[model samples]
Target chain A: MKTLALFVVVITGAMLIYAGHDLPAFGDINSPSYQAPMTQYFINNSLEESGVTNIVTALLASYRGYDTLGETAVIFTAGMAVMLLLRRRER
Target chain B: MSRIQESVIIRTIVRIMVPFIELFALYVIMHGASGPGGGFQGGVIFGAAIILYTMIYGIAEGKKKMSDSLDRILASTGLTIYAATGLICIVCGGMFLQYRAVPLLPDPAEVSKYLIDLVEIGIGITVLAVMISLFFDVSPPESEPEEAEE
Candidate 1:
């Protein structure tokens, strides 16, 4: 198990290093992370349409909420599993 | 907890500061749509409120206010609100949570924008509740109210 873990970590580190080369130039202001496409769309349309001040908030709450919902479900399942494990059994 | 209770000065200061911290959390939750803050950030703040309750008063007192049953229900309810909202979008004859198909208002494009924010609120609540449950599950047995504080 320890060897397997070490192998997994090494492969993950290698993949990250490879991917890092193609990454968007370490945070350029005009890069996709900065002034990219989707943020602009949310900024242009959702602000006045939704009457929300923060464009990022509007995007997260509205556009990507489905993904967020799935995340919540995942957490709920984990909590339930833990409860089953730890809660004392009835005599 | 024992340390905090032992220090009179820390106790007085935290007691005074907790309300203000909680107020900031509420502000984060409410004003999430306008700025960098939103449901997720605000929800974490809400969890922090409970953490404060646990720290100062002890886990038993905290657990009195929030039991295992409460955490389970909250965790489930949060997910239900989120999933149900998505199912509503599907029932309205759209793809899974595809807001354009939901017929929210006369101006289809307009509602699409607003629907996103509402969905985000549901997401925030669910995620926060679940995270709190997870936090407690991994908490040391020393902190388990049934074992110690109770």
Candidate 2:
């Protein structure tokens, strides 16, 4: 079982390393991500639209606020689950 | 674990550092609008402070600081704040979570920024409370259940 797990890890690591070659270089301006229309729109107007200097914060808290709300719910649920499962009956 | 816990240096350092850790966490949450932090990161950091305190001081002491009831209240309050903000937007004639339409501020962009900060705060509060609660629940006093059963 340990050998099989090791084999799986080695295969997956090799695949990931091979895939890395196709990725854009760090901070490459001409990268496909940088050229996306949405990326350009965010860069151009996030400050004006959201009044936030940080683009990531603007996107998370305003443009994608609903998604953040859902994520908060997920965290809350997980906490509740842990509390319920592990709580001892206080006498 | 008991030997380390009893070490005066370890206890003294943790006692001194916990307040600073908490302060930094608050800074991260507040400065997240203009910097490299947000609700999740800040919340986790804040939670870590309490967890560290619990580890050093024992669960009973930790519980004294943040009771189970308080933990539950704080967790719900964070979610409530987020949901209430969305509801306010809806009441103000906008879709849910539409910060610009809330009409609290004249400038739409300013409104968005303000709401974003508020939402981040709510996330921070919930995440911090939940993390503390999870730690306490998962690592209860080993003799607690046996004592109760007896």
Candidate 3:
């Protein structure tokens, strides 16, 4: 059973690596995302538009603030779930 | 205390290092708008400082510093701050999370810069509180669960 599991893992890994060959090289200018107009717009105007020097911060907190707000809620929910499940009651 | 935690050297170093680590976390959070670090990373670092303190000083001592009630409040407060910022935008006649809609500053971009910082702070607080509470919950209870300080 262990050998069969290992065989499955190895085949899956090999298939993933084989499929990775089609990916663009890191930071390739010709990559679809890099060539997109939105990407260019963000890169060029994030600082002036958002007044945040860090483009990632500008994107997260200003451009996509709703998404980040949702992420924060998710974190809060996880904490609450852990507390509810694990907290010991006082005797 | 365990032999390792009982060490004078370890205790002294941790005591000295925790404040600095927390200070660095604050720096990471505030500088996030201008630099590489952000709220999530900063909060994790801040939580780690407390966890390290707990490891050496024991859970009871750690709890005294950040009581369970306080942790819950901070967690809620951070989320409130984030949500409030968005609500304020709507009240000011703009879409949610729309920094320009806030009329605090003369320049919309300037308002955005400051609001971004405020939002980052909210994220940092929530992350810090949650991380610390999660660590407290998961770590094994000391030999005596309640106030076992020697």
Give Cα-based local distance difference scores for all models.
0.66, 0.87, 0.89
Give the docking tier of candidate 1. acceptable
C-alpha RMSD between model 1 and the true structure: 4.9
Indicate the residue-level lDDT of B59 in model 2: 80
Higher-DockQ candidate of 1 and 3: 3
Please report the candidate that would top DockQ against the real structure. 3
Off by over 4 Å in 1: A1-24, A29-43, A48-53, A88-91, B100-117, B140-150
Over B1-150, each residue of candidate 1 has an lDDT whose tens digit, in order, gives 566565888667877876787678667766666556766776777777666666676666667767777877776776776677678878998767666677768876566656655665665565556655655655655653322111
Alpha-carbon deviation at A79 in model 1, angstroms:
2.2
Q: Could you tell me the TM-score of chain B in model 3?
A: 0.93
Compose the digit string of candidate 2's lDDT tens values, residues A1-91.
9999999999999999999999999999999999999999998999998899999999998888899899999999999987777664653
lDDT of 3 by residue, B44-82 (tens): 899888888887888899998788999999999999999
Ranking by lDDT: 3, 2, 1
Interface root mean square deviation of every model, in Å? 3.2, 0.8, 0.6
Count of clashing residue pairs in every prediction: 6, 0, 0
Error of 2 at A7 (Å): 3.9
